[model samples]
Target: MRIPIGRFTVPPEQPVVEEKTPSPSDKEAGVVSEQHPSDHESDNDAISSDAQAGVKKIEATTKVWSKSHLIAAYIGIWIIYFVDAMQQGTGTLLTPYVTSSFQEHSLTATTSVFSSLIGGISKLTLAKILDIWGRPQGYMITVLLMTVGLIMMAACQNVQTYAAAQVFYWVGYNGISYTLSVFIADTSSLKNRGFMLAFVSSPYIATVWITGPMAQSLLQGIGFRWGFGIFSIITPIMCLPLFFLFTYNYQKAKKQGLVVIEKSGRTFWQSVVHYFWEFDVICLILLSGGFALFLLPFSIYSYQAYGWRDPLTICLIIFGGLLLIGAFVWEAYFAPVQFLPWSLLRDRTVMGACCLAAILFVEYYIWNSYFTSWLQVVLNLNVTQTGYVSNIYSIGSCFFSFFVGIAIRWTGRFKWIAVYFGVPLTILSIGLLIHFRQPDTHLGYIIMCEIFYAFAGGALVICEQIAVMAAAAHQHVAVVLAMEGMFSSVGGAIGSSIAAGIWTGVFPVKLAEYLPAESQGDLASIYGDINVQLSYPIGSPTRTAIMDAYGEAQKWMLVGATAITGLAIICVVAWRDIKVKDFKQVKGLVA
Candidate 1:
């Protein structure tokens, strides 16, 4: 009987005529079906086993880098950072020689132009080069640029020639600095990024501190050619290991198909535009601008205006640099961004942070470039001892940076920190500088002032970074950072130029005024040996008396710092009461 189920009824006689099934040996042999629960269970087990085996194979075949490799990468980054420091530190030593040999400050300006070109211009151009050519090639190219620059510097006789050399030097400098940062970011996980970053920074600090005195010693003893030549040789040797490191990384990336750009799309314009819209690019510009602005008066004026011959100036600059770096990270991670669809700089908090950073950096630069030089020029400290004493700023900055980080974490608001610690210390630093007029004033007082300034500067740096980041929504952090750098650089360049103009303009007029009218023209010859003013026995009384006339120039620097910092306070005030925006809700606007 047939059983009927639903729509159609089964016919009772449908299977009455049964046909014979085909034999197994036949071409159309029938297949057998296994219906046992055990067969299904066994098949499932086999599939699971195959998956586990695949996972095991992956675990076993995947290469985990050795500790030695990790250490090598770390050290390699450190060396890259170290080279940039050495360039700056050694350049500080070479400045006097370059100025004297060229007999023109304009040549020095040319060198500055070259330096800026490599740093700002090249960074824009090379970003794409890195993407297309890969990081290894970019790194190697940078090493070559640096090597060529140093070699040219060693061989320079004229100002133009030396300035030309700076182009190459700066190219190398920007290349390595930018590429290494990219490499680190690519290789490290987010959790350990902070430590790795710190590892890179530590070398910068350590090298800067040591390079100054060492560079100075080399300049004084073996002369500039050999001193700078050594760097040329060392740069390539130091970069050799990087060749292997970068190659390994590139090969790995190739295998993974991680390279984004191809050689066909490579062009200077394309490279620049590639990074223009990137968040990190903006951040780099902003931070660099802040740094540049801070550096302006000091970098341009210290050697010429105050006749500073101390290495400590550089050390102090690095102190602030390291502190601000930490502050930047905290800000970028924690702060919000504004104008999410466009720019990152419109955020008030970030603007305030930039302002404060600008203030502190400018103040620090003044001391680094001018005060120490004034101490030696006006107070007459010997070179050896003065270099050691320059560490006062470093001592103060290092101590305070640690404290400021804690203060921000403890207190949610950054306003009080800016007002209470930031502005007051900056004002007081200027005050201390103004009062530091007496030739016989104790060095201890100066050191104390520097310490105080460093403390204040540290607080300001942290506050500004936090505020700026807070001001912007999260998506624009990198853009804000780049803007900060660009502004800082412009500010610094202008400040330094002003300082140079002031010194070159003032010193000669004062010297001329104190000299006899007939001897005024002849006194110009004595400018190369400005120490003659301190030691009348070495030259003439007219130069000494003329130098004495400008005993008040040092005090003017204090007034300038005070004025700049006052402007900074106004920026700080403007920065207050701004609300930070949340970026997560606007993620589509970000990219």
Candidate 2:
């Protein structure tokens, strides 16, 4: 039965069909192979056992869809990914302008640290929700959140409200992206899985080109509010088809008894309590609380007049460190459920992939946090040009990532390719950035480095993504992928914190050091606003001074980014050699 909501009809909920225990002969004949989730918390197949049968049904029949039906499904997935990417890409470009409008531009990286932590946890929660309730239900929830975020952003009166809205936006964004990955995983065999993922993620290529132009139009035309408002309306509509398709197929599978939902054989209250323990609520709380306390100081310290010496900042840093320690202690000893299963923790490949993913974010954000601002201020580029130059990374990465996918399929080896090829190229590109990122270097040389880094980074992304997915059985892929993403998001937050810390601490001093004595009094105003820096005429004394100061900061940032990225190379080199040719997909179980 469809639930009507004004003009739209919600997809029919799955009809509850109680599972039956199979007889001895049925078991002997291989009529069912149901593996239960661990009784305790896990990153394995640890959703409620009742959801397993439904999920099993999805895994089983996904490969059995008629060719046309499969095409339609693929089409829906592509549409969902494309629209979401379009919105996220354009919106990300508009964010600094919005922050600048509130005259609190310093808070940009700080707020992202908060949001990434929220988004990380939210990714895991939604993965669980989608795995249990059904994809459409999760999709609806995410879309609702994203729409709310967009609407709030459009209506926001201050920096605080806008930051609050970003949390919801990230949740929905991560959820939708997660769904897209799972959708591809559900359909593809290991043989072409890498290729399939790349094909679906191709939207980034378009968004790189399109969002720059679109953001420029919105920035110079009506305004960011209109842009946000328009996306609030369009995003949910664009997502409807994909979730509808997934729901229809899943419900159809259930109706035909292709699979069955199991009874947990527990009372309502017991099951509720069971899930709380099973989802590792305590662990999540500790992790979030601890990381927030630990990470926020990096960005917020500058806000305090006393800076690092402020009692509040010092207290928060200490408290945050203690909480992080508490989280580890709880996970290791007192918790019934834990964030990562010990088995996964022991898997070198998975850990290596996780580390590589995390470090990449740290590396990227170290320099990336302010490169666009550098472009506009030092290079005298406008918003559109700044956006275009910035997107050279996205453009090359997305396009060549598609190539990496096919290369992985053809070469049938990921570990060595990343270690030997992706790693070295990425290192070279970043090394080039150290020299060319300065104001004296021509812009074309800088673009070339970004392109080179993008190509290598693209390959590295696919390698790490597929490596994690390959390590886990299909049944656990959602959680595993979510976990890797969690690592990345947290790493990104930390990276943002480090960058923000360096920027806030160093940029002001550099500004003061470089400016003439007569201009010393204007240093605070100049440091606080990018607009003020850009207002100085090109080649003028003030502009030239700002360039030299900014170039100094950029030099240090790029050095830090380069040093951090070397860790990713170590991760790749230490990765267990898993070849695509040797992979097996049996009943969604990895081999």
Candidate 3:
């Protein structure tokens, strides 16, 4: 039987354009080609030049809607950013809610259910839809999904209902964001792509910074449902401007016959299969695995295990936003096609960079989630102190990641830098986590740890991003990026789940064993209560058990981070080196 591989294939060549010059008699057709010696392209170009030369076009004569249209575009982008930020920022919160709703659920069960429902199916389905439908249409469908899902979540009466709605909403929204990034890539020019993409990321930063206060205020004033209800209002409101931008772009492209996409006429399943067959497929798979491993544990740590002051969560989130924004800019402008490219995987220099980035991400999750909690819970610092100490990591990452891009450009040899600095730093940082696993660390010691890890990890991440894009062929860059994002998301989910499960399952069993016979009745009663309002406190056996469990969990994360980095090192080893030839030379070689 012949295999039916239905997938969109990358264009084999740029569209062949045939230039024609009109004869003098047919001058009305307007010769716009450079081959025509005349300065005038058309009566329209002449008129456009003449009108603008004499005077600044008066405001009254200019298009009135341009300003409105631009405003709408900005707002539309903000809305997308807002929802995206929340989906990520609120991930930790969601697991606990799911756990509570399903009383007998293990962390693995909850995470697996969530990953399959939200990450796996949602991403795959939405990706297909994005390919078939234009960005605007896909975005509209996403908005509809989120709106309906949020409404359902607000009204949810049980665990299964909530999970189903979350899956529906996440699939649409997540897919739309990925498609939007591709859309942004297409719309932007090379010179400004980096800055423009960074501009788009501003909302993620703003949301992280602002949502803490907003969530706290709402929770205090109205309660959980009302807080979510008020937040949900922002979703539909954000879509109004998107409606205008998407509609305008779609219509303009349609009129110009510029909206044509290469449709290979492959069946849907074939397309997915073809997607996986490409070398870019491995990047996606690995990155997703890394992300799931890291994020799953981190998400559950905040609420389920640590009960951190809310502001701390917010600050860490904002820091992540900043680092990601920097990464976005680096990916867009400096190394648009290199950072996560298939070509990069072929080059040892660039592969080292990509490996470094994955390792940095793992370090970021481990230090931010576990290390900070260790300082607060074990060291006994107040929330304010922990917040300040933790923010130090972000500060270090922000400064170094920005400069590292320029440094790579200055040095010209990224391979030497990555192998010498990045690989070692990653190994060392993981070592720090394992070595510094004391029961009660001092504040100054914690600050020193943050400064070292953040600076090294941050710089490595920036280099890796640049390396991936810088090494890839131009057309394959976007595919590489999409793969990177998929993995990052998956890693995060995995990290949070691992952390939560270790604490909840292992520690609880230990607690049952550790309690004295006389106090056992009291402990069992306390644990059994299960109500939000517990009458007992004072370092009860239950609380101690929870803390000890989490402390042990931290050790496991250190081991996992070290192991993952080891794999990254192997991937680096797999990478072969290629000389950096000019784009024209590279293109000729590929051809």
Candidate 4:
């Protein structure tokens, strides 16, 4: 999906290449060979047929459009991104409130765990769909899922139903993000890829500031339900143009013989069976189920009447572990087609990128999952004030990443910057947070910590993204990138689970320990809603107890986050230092 630099003009007619999977009989049995062509194979080495098709597909789809089409596509993509970003920003504001209504505020992170698991994994599935059905089909499917989830969220009657809706929304959310990311990767050369990647997320800079106030107003006026309902209509509308452009261009590519369809002659049912095997559906199911079961316990086990002693909790955790093991065994020994490109599994740079992203996400989510509530309750901030403080990490990340992207463009490098600044900043942020996240700390101090973490988080995210993509050629971009996103999101799921375990387990105990003896009877109410905690005046016994409880519970989570982030440095050092100099050099990956 390479476009001409600056102009984005369509390429010349390409040769027809039939789409199909690599055969088990051949060495390139998966979607890609286990070794990179440049790494192990000489220039004269014969490329496999499936590799040729893949390469050709990438070339053909690099098809761009006229000036007007380009403008429309560029605008459409950004607009859709803006709408989605706005929706998410507001949704985050409302989720705690929704949980409070159900008297399940403590379960907020638990709900997010399910969503992150589903959404993160959906990237792998969407990548496969893009490979088989084309980009437009995958994009439209995600849009549909997103709209349905939005509608369900507005209408959901209970926490269980809302959790299901959250899962649906997250799947679509990850899918949309994945599609947009692939779009950027498909169009830009490696030299400018870093900048482009950061540029797209620039919407967050504005949305972050606006969403809090906007959501606050909406909550006061029409309510959270209407907010979700309005967005359900708006997001899909913004998506229409991009969907049309991809579909139109794809059909035109097909007509020009630049894109060839598979001609496997089989009945419809047989074809379905073939794709099931080709996609390794059973493997995906096992993987998803394993993660869901294993992670669910950490988030929900404390809520059970029997707690950790519950037989159901023990069985679920054991079965989940077994299922995960089964998935690994299957992927390693028996799957016909692997989810990630085979060579990606062997690429040190790619693995390092995935590991780095996973580590960052794990650390970020562990402390961040319940951070807003912490700010509101402990600092005595309103919803809008909490939003202002909460947005600093993300806004700063986007703000810093844009400049870092430009730095990457000029330097033709990223690894050194990440090691020197990103890692150190992360360590510093944690160190500051240890002090600032305490009871009655000045609000400015907390913001300072967030700013540091924001820079570290953004830099690491951009570096890993560029590192992973730079290691792969055009043909393997979607698969490798999807794998990275999958790992990152899975890490987030794990972090959310840990946070849930800590917050639910430690927070209530702390509350019980610190609250006045007479107030013990109201423990459940205070534990479930920050609003109730906020009702008591500052410096009062009850308020003091609440603040002390919040501080003690989160102190351990911050320490754990900092401890986990140390692994990020190892990931940075392990990467293969590839310089992005020109699109033609090393097929636009390495200089």
**TM-score of each predicted structure versus truth:** 0.63, 0.88, 0.60, 0.92
lDDT of 4 at 530: 66
* TM-score, predicted candidate 3 vs. hidden true structure: 0.60
State which candidate has the highest TM-score.
4
lDDT of 3 by residue, 233-253 (tens): 877776667666556644543
Question: For residues 1-591, could you state the per-residue lDDT of candidate 1 as single tens digits?
Answer: 111111221211111111111111111111111121222343111111111111111111112233455457667777767776666555654555565565553223335532552354345335434432345666788889988988988899987788778768866775676566555533443223323444464443455366557756875788778877888988888888967864564345335432222233446665455434322444444444445443443534434434433445454456546645743763456323211222334445555666565555554444344343455455565443444455545445544655665454445456777777778887887687678654546777887777777778666655665455444422222334434443343444444444444555455566667776666666655444434444453234663454454455555655666778787777777665422221121100000
Q: Indicate whether candidate 1 or candidate 3 has the larger lDDT.
A: 1
lDDT of 4 by residue, 505-559 (tens): 8999999999999889999999998668878899889999999988987898999
Give the worst 10-residue stretch by lDDT in candidate 1.
582-591
Ranking of all candidate structures by their lDDT, best first: 4, 2, 1, 3
Comparing 1 and 3 on TM-score, the stronger one:
1
- lDDT tens digits, residue span 7-28, model 2: 1122222334433321111111
- Quote the positional error of residue 246 for candidate 2 in Å: 0.7
Residue 234 in candidate 2, Cα distance off native in Å: 1.0
Show pairs that collide, candidate 2. none
Pick out the ten consecutive residues of candidate 4 with the lowest summed lDDT.
582-591
lDDT of 1: 0.50
Report residue 190 deviation for candidate 3 (angstroms): 5.9
Q: Report the candidate with higher TM-score, 2 versus 3.
A: 2
Q: Which ten residues in a row have the lowest lDDT in candidate 3?
A: 52-61
Clashing pairs in 4: none
